[model samples]
Target: MSPAPWDSEPRAQGPTGPCGLQFRPRMDMAKLEEARLFIQSMDYRRTTWQDDDGDTILHIYTAKGQREYAFAAAERLQELGRLDSKEHKGKTALLVAVTANQPEIVQDLLSLGADISMCDIKGQTALHLAATYGFPEVMQVRGRERMPLSTCLTPLHCAVISHGATMKAPTSVQGRHTWLVSLCQLVLSLISQEIKSNKTALHLAVKDGNIQLVHFFLKQPLPDMQAFINMKAHGHTALHMAAGLHTSLHQEDIIRLLLTRGADPSVRNLENDQPAHLLQSGEQGEKVRRGRGTSLVGECS
Candidate 1:
């Protein structure tokens, strides 16, 4: 009975951000009722934000963190079965949830049929947003398999670059853990199955020194360390990752795992350098160089 979000009339902006949060600005509740009625009329199809940017009203809410209004609107959309609809950016409601680091919201969207693998114009996916924010929406996983949040970068690599570690799932289950964990686990499983650029999640795990994630990833049945641990992206391996971490329990463990799993300890990067060459070296250029190398493949090898 509901027309697709794409079939709906043009809207001014895409709604995004957190849902159900209290607001200080007193918007017309009557207007909200009207919006709700509009939602029902549209069969929960997302209102389009036909800007040049192509972002939807959903994108606006998630990016800006509008809590309650966004949540209410999102719920209406889910009920109408349009939660996965994308705007001009090729982003889904799941992507917005990942961007906002709202695990519960992410679960809600996924349950309502959001696709986890769609890439945006920027080649980003829900995982990229989660990893970029260091929000491990994954520790909730059970199996080794995972899926891509996007095409340009796996969630693991995204986690490595921004957080200097692995993407983890939230350990706590809370109220929405089942869906969150299932979604996170599915992503993980898909990631494990596909070895992009000849790298597995294990390779990525070691490269970024994500001890929890790395250790957790190895527990999966896929045991091809040499295929990945020894492999190089931009001339760096997980061992190179081991030397240049901020030092945490899991961080140290990832290094140990890589070494134990046969990550070449002596690999170097395009600059003929190793991660050790850049550790804690407060020289201005050193930080920049390290950042550059790490950004390429999740390490300063």
Candidate 2:
């Protein structure tokens, strides 16, 4: 007959059951009442009543941002040894909460003993999703709860790799750059952690020609800042990457920052080529070489 009132909201669309029943969305009072009654009548023992995608009642509520129902269902699920249950996509309710941007539901699920360590089929944890999706509030919640930052890629790496134009908005609106800088400040120790190819966040930023990112990493008050700026990926330092990048408008700026911040120009790569040797010819390259030579001479004397 007619579509449900909550169906108009994109976030309200959830997995359809065999009966074609969809979960109610937040702010739909009448449908919420119906869902509340349905949840109350649901037999906690019969926990396998999921939709085609293997999402249980808990998954639906969390996905729809039904805070109170989701919280109660989470508590019941926790007691029944199902608080961390996964759907067909390997996403637990906690993961769904983060994806839904329901930070309040996220906090509640975590408090109800949801497994913070749970990852999706892609092996991305809740923290990774939060960072990749630019949900600083979710990240802040994890930080406030003192959640360990120990994922393989780490949240810092995810933020850097996923940052793009959409995240470049003004700082007042939580731009990606501002969000990444805040994360760096919060987890300075994790900044140096590398991913595949031994590429640290600095390496990725430099490779992406992100001058602002390079500047932020270099400016951190790490104990051994030189070692950080010079971290290698496939035997190439960030300085080497910067030197090799000739097309980016920020290329010279990146190279200059790396040199001034103790990047060892004399350091050789796998082929024994120093950053200066990788530099292209002409005015810009000459400026970089001059700065590199000066830094080297200063280091030597």
| Candidate 1: regions farther than 4 A off | 1-35, 38-52, 64-68, 71-85, 137-152, 165-301
Best by TM-score: 2
Tens digits of lDDT, candidate 1, 33-68: 654565556421235333455555555555554433
Model 2 CA lDDT for position 230: 80
Off by over 4 Å in 2: 1-37, 44-47, 144-151, 165-178, 185-191, 281-301
Error of 1 at 188 (Å): 4.3
| Model 1 lDDT, residue 53, Cα | 57
In model 2, which range of ten residues has the least summed lDDT?
A: 292-301
lDDT of 2 by residue, 146-242 (tens): 4455556877888888775435533343345566766766654634666567889888889999877788777778888888888788999988898
How much does each candidate deviate from the true structure in C-alpha RMSD?
10.8, 6.8
Cα displacement (angstroms), candidate 1, residue 300, comes to: 24
Task: Judging by lDDT against the true structure, name the best candidate.
Answer: 2
Quantify all predictions' global Cα lDDT against the true fold.
Answer: 0.50, 0.71
Model 1 TM-score, 2 decimals: 0.47
